[model samples]
Target: MEITLLQGIIITIVIMIIVVDRHLEALFIFRPIIVCPIVGAILGDLNTGLLAGGIVELAFAGIAGIGGASVPEALLTSVMTVVFAHITGNDVATSLALAYPFGVLMQFTWTIRNTAFTAFNAPAERYAKEGNVKGLMKLCFYGIVITMIITGILTFLSVYAAQAPLKAFVEAMPDWVINGFQVAGGLLPAVGFAMLLRVTLKGKYVPYLLAGFLFATFIQIDNVLPVAIMGVAFALMEYYRSGEKEPVTIKGGEESGI
Candidate 1:
């Protein structure tokens, strides 16, 4: 009943695919951290599940969906964090032993999946020409479903396959390895930040970005909750500032039109 890495991975995959395929909702809850704990709950490790999920969530605080892609690879991080957490006594920092690498691996998979989806869109357009909205949706839906299912299965199976190595690594890891992982923890935030830059960044928004970063780092805004407040405030200020009517200058530098 204690969800092993293999079973946890398996369940997480199924849930992830369902969310990704059916909902098209950014795969948020079905993410690795949430999925892990739910699996753990089913497996009688509720505490472990919750703890693992919380830790991964913090580490992935900056993760965001930009039109579609997410940076620092939330999916892989969530999944692997729970798995490693399960293996390593629910110590959040320790989970990074595999979570970071797993995230990188998932990034490759996601890029490949999206590329295939883009390619499929062309054929889907042909189907769309024939009044086949259903067909087009099917193309996108089934394609995503298939990809999710395959990744889910492979993730679970790979967990099992890698279990021995994971155990060995955890056991034999030098203190430096642990130290390195902890240090890697600080750097992980940069990944999400960089990815966010790629997604929401624009030329005029630099001040807001810097402000949010400063508030978060220096002003002690904790978690997504406070950040959301600050973001909303920032947005309101920007909106009103930009919405203010500007005066039109005439040839003599005087306002002409009201």
Candidate 2:
């Protein structure tokens, strides 16, 4: 599927919006789960977009930019995965495996951008000291605009310009290699979940986790909606139970200060 200029422009604009929103930490739509579907809609392949998004979302579930730690670029990976899958007619797993390198590349780019942006700190401080509101506003505006433009341009080039080469590379690969990618991609979500559990799992939560696993594994259902609802119900019950106050007991089993 060849991407037209108009579609490329629209996708670029959407990427710009997502990137700016990510920087502002507003709306929280920068995640792969949200970004991929939107891009897929634009590309006229919502199913592939949804599939790619879900897999990538779970794979990166435990990963986040905490404090000074660096994380892979989820937005770029999602966009490229959807685009590559749609254009090359590849499986979601293979697309995800292929798109991961792009995410790492963008991660490096992000680090460089952050380092470069430090130069603006001096100007920002000077404007603050001089009480120049307009100057400060202009600086912020320029910073956002530059970020938006750079992200948009890079996304466009990656999606449009590299499509042919990427498609060729995928086509040239052997069946075993493709299968290996599928295997790796399929394991990534489980690894991500394990990482999350390592951090958040507790003794009290083990039972609930086991129950969920049983429900998901032993009981075959059309969807996981029932299991999800059960989880929510348990969570609500625990919340309310925790909020209740225990009755006070006196020496003779009588309430104190009654």
In order, the Cα lDDT scores of the candidates are 0.64, 0.85
Q: What is the lDDT of residue 78 in candidate 2?
A: 93
Q: Taking the tens digit of each residue's C-alpha lDDT, what string does model 2 give over 1-258?
A: 877778888998999999998777789899899999999999999998999989999888887776746778888999998987888888888888888888888888788888898989999999999999999999889889888987888898888888888888888999998888888888877867876786767766787889898999989888779899989999999999878885673434222221
Best by TM-score: 2
Query: Candidate 2's error at 122, in angstroms?
Result: 0.8
Q: How much is the lDDT of residue 192 in candidate 1?
A: 53
- lDDT string for model 1 (27-108, tens) is 4575546765775565566776677676666566657555675455655566566666666663656675457787677667
What is the model-wide C-alpha lDDT for candidate 1?
Answer: 0.64
- Would you give me the overall lDDT of model 2? 0.85
Q: Which segments of model 1 are wrong by more than 4 Å?
A: 1-6, 9-13, 16-23, 30-33, 39-43, 47-72, 116-134, 197-238, 247-258
Model 2 scores worst on lDDT over the 10 consecutive residues at: 249-258
* TM-score, candidate number 1: 0.69
Candidate 2 residue pairs that clash: none
**Per-residue error (Å), model 2, residue 223:** 3.2
Candidate 2 TM-score over all chains jointly: 0.88
